[model samples]
Target: MTAGLSRRAAICGIGQTEFSKESGRTELQLACECVKSALDDAGLSPADVDGLVTFTMDTTEEIDVVRNLGIGELSMFSRVPYGGGAAAGTVLQAAMAVATGVADVVVCYRAFNERSGMRFGGFASTLTSMPLFLSWYGPYGLLTPASWVALHARRYMETYGVTNADFAPIAVVDRKHAATNPDAWFHGRPITVEDHQASRWIVEPVLRLLDCCQESDGGVAIVVTSTERARDLRQVPAVIEAAAQGATFDGESMTSYYRDDLTGLQEMGAVARRLWSMSGLSPDDIQTAFLYDHFTPFVLMQLEELGFCGRGEAKEFATVENLSIGGRLPINTNGGLLGEAYIHGMNGITEGVRQVRGTSHNQVDAVEHVLVTSGTGVPTSGLILGRD
Candidate 1:
């Protein structure tokens, strides 16, 4: 079922810049700094990094980073498209390179001034470079990520009788975890369901302000290498038990309206199947999850898509006691795109690594396998990580 890349590559290091509205530096600096931080965490230097991967939306060029970090001739350099969806795909690219001997060590990074320079949530007058699927929605005034997601969110809510209230717990739990994470932008700031209900609607009847993730200015990076090489490095390695990327039939970016239904993320389901097949693990084996929480309703959809719950049952499965740290399946312990900084889901992967290392601030108990997912409503990707 797999190409035999599973567990051959492991994430050895993780690092990031402060989650903030303003970093006061160029995205290039943020990119270089985070890579250096990850390299430091892995006890490796720039020269040791022979491969690199990042998002197409990222402003920092590969050559600039390579030159700034003093990295030597690179064997592999890749750019995964699809904003938010490229998070785990970056790991997939790095892993494939490492597993096939194309490169020995690879660093995956993402950097942007989302809040200060280019806000992902802001209305785009003309995004010519956006995915072709997204252009379809612009004619209807779906000019922002929030507006685009609102279409599916409203459809899912209507199909299942789900309400705006059911999505509040996700935000509450994320902020609860962020309240304890010193590095989170919303650190020490936890909100309640009542607060979420009171928050003004971003897309009325579909999403509220609290339900939307912050547009953060930050950078995050991960180091991938052979399991053998990772074991000999600094931190405990988060073995890549499995990694997968999927784009479903008729799937479109943000607006997957052409599918059989709008209730579930078909692409995410495809990714879940491959992760299960490649890892030889079932949903019951996942001790924790680092789900992408760009929107709370999507978090619920991801839970169902990942097989954590039956379709339409996520409304009941996502409880305060359950999503919390000592619960059946704690998630987003480092805060998430919602409560932490939204570095296009790269921060979620970093938190997954911390969970595997058993060093997370809101660490779960005996985390054996951590499930990390990319964005929803798009060609998404996912990863299954475990202790080596």
Candidate 2:
């Protein structure tokens, strides 16, 4: 039997602003723009919305967005933490609200002028109070996000005997997909494995400029309602099969190096287990995946943790032909964060919906189940979305 929450909620609409390096607008403005578009897509007036979910790190407040968008009084509002890791949690929270009747017509959104306003990659030092772990590691020159993820990426390579060549295929395939996606920042500009090999190093031995996701500026918003109500909406419903958040023991934000094995993502493993159980679907059920690719190495690790492939096999499983539009499990069909714009993984959720709706520009054939994971190597979340 399907769980009450599993098929109760469906994504009725998705909207976003153009991805860019500099939006030249306030975070509030961007948030409002996306929410307005999402509501319009759902054929909902702002007054019809009663719930809101967003990232804790988002600069715009819930009230600010609601007021600006002319949304009526809200019965539910929530915020998820841990930067990109909170992506799926936003929808999960909204689904919960809609499923239990805590609210109807929930809007989940994330917005920022990350590149032009506050660059996360450019952030260094503990300006205020430091994270206890960062205080210990920060002085040792572990400052930027690239350097932080590099620690785990380096250890993963050593454990699995993965080389730069193994990592090149991921970038190559993502860029290939992006080349066909006009909205992707790197669209129309596919790269070769040789190109990935030649890119300048961001952090030695693992990440290169090509491996890192764009520091983009934009917003994405999703509309969630009961599957029953969704059927009355304008678009095909992307039912929420499962939604879960997980953090393993001793879990830190991004620098979760204290885990037993750096070769895989334990937090993502927890989410995968719950998602499979809650959705009554295994790895075999997923036709496409929107694995978070903020960094390339984690994408491989996510494949392993999510049970798409066994441990130590992700290096080989990540191939251009194997993961392309016609591949068995086409991934990041909207070009992912690497190719498309990075709206802190919210864009991935949108792409998942597109795949289910058969409206993606890089549409995968016969897509019934789409798996999407948030930031790996951190306290993360995952969602299983499928056609209703």
Candidate 3:
């Protein structure tokens, strides 16, 4: 076991630009805005920042952000790859930096114009030209995310007898939470199981258009510092009880089709094992879950992989009041990527902080520990946020 770090890191500040399909702004501008907001929220200035972490996919680089934001010297700077999988990993990097005294204050951020500028869902031929690994799958008609995930979803249905209706409750519950959250992209728009069933199919027997997340253009950021120092910050510190990133054997980005198990998120399973072991908490201790909802089926799969339910039991768990607000475990009170803006899971981390602060728009009563996960069907990451 890699012994846990001694000093606990806590998120003392959170900030984000409005979640939307079209922000009409440059990615750099969005990054600066969010960085400034987070700094202000932390009751600190740009000069106080000594570390920075962001996604490798992010267009805004560290030097550019530092110069643009008028930030001073930085002691540590790094980036994680694999798009949405880097969400919690960015925070993990920041927290590690702060905990080790390599930096006093660190910020993790992600910003993009994914919708109006460059829609990721729209298939592009460039993927075929990228690398040999992607080339192998591109020629096989596994060109789109939905198509790649469909294969696994089909296998899951075949093995578990799960159906489209079984995935409906995930969307229904997230939309219900979104309906009450003014910041949510789907605010005031609650859906029923009928709505999920009625939505147009994106992939046969696997997903519908509504079952997938939106292409949002915005930015979200979080500030990390030692829990002791965070006590004097502006907001109630959301302690980082544990943070972990995991990639399972034979991991292949979003298209991990070669894995021995098609129905499980082994990468996420690895993250869950480390998170629970380090945090000394179990599924029963989680007050709410912010599992990645890039697709509804993946949400069910995550419930199973994270040990919230047994394998092939997530559909039953969802139907048996395990996923509702008043049920055993509420999930995605921020509406998730399905009903909320999808900033590649950055928004999910912000929601985890809100729950810890007891200020979430869809606040769960007496939230102590919240589990926030990154993108599934890939090398993913997770965080256990708790009250300090």
Best by lDDT: 1
Query: Which ranges of candidate 2 are over 4 A from the true structure?
Result: 125-133
Candidate 3 per-residue lDDT, tens place, 69-88, comes to 78899999999888799999
Of the candidates numbered 1 and 3, which has the greater lDDT value?
A: 1
Please provide the root mean square deviation of candidate 3 (C-alpha atoms, Å). Answer: 1.6
Q: List ranges where model 3 is wrong by over 4 Å.
A: 1-3, 125-131
Encode model 2's per-residue lDDT on 182-281: one tens digit a residue: 8898889999988998999999887999999988999999999999999999999999999999988987788887768777788898999889999999
2 versus 3: better TM-score goes to: 2
Q: Among all windows of ten consecutive residues in candidate 1, which has the lowest summed lDDT?
A: 123-132
lDDT score for candidate 3 against the true structure: 0.88
Q: Least lDDT summed over 10 consecutive residues: which range in candidate 3?
A: 123-132
List per-candidate RMSD values in Å.
1.6, 1.5, 1.6
Model 3 clash pairs are none
Backbone clash pairs in model 3 (N, Cα, C under 3 Å; residues 3+ apart or in different chains), count: 0
What is candidate 2's CA lDDT for residue 338? Answer: 89
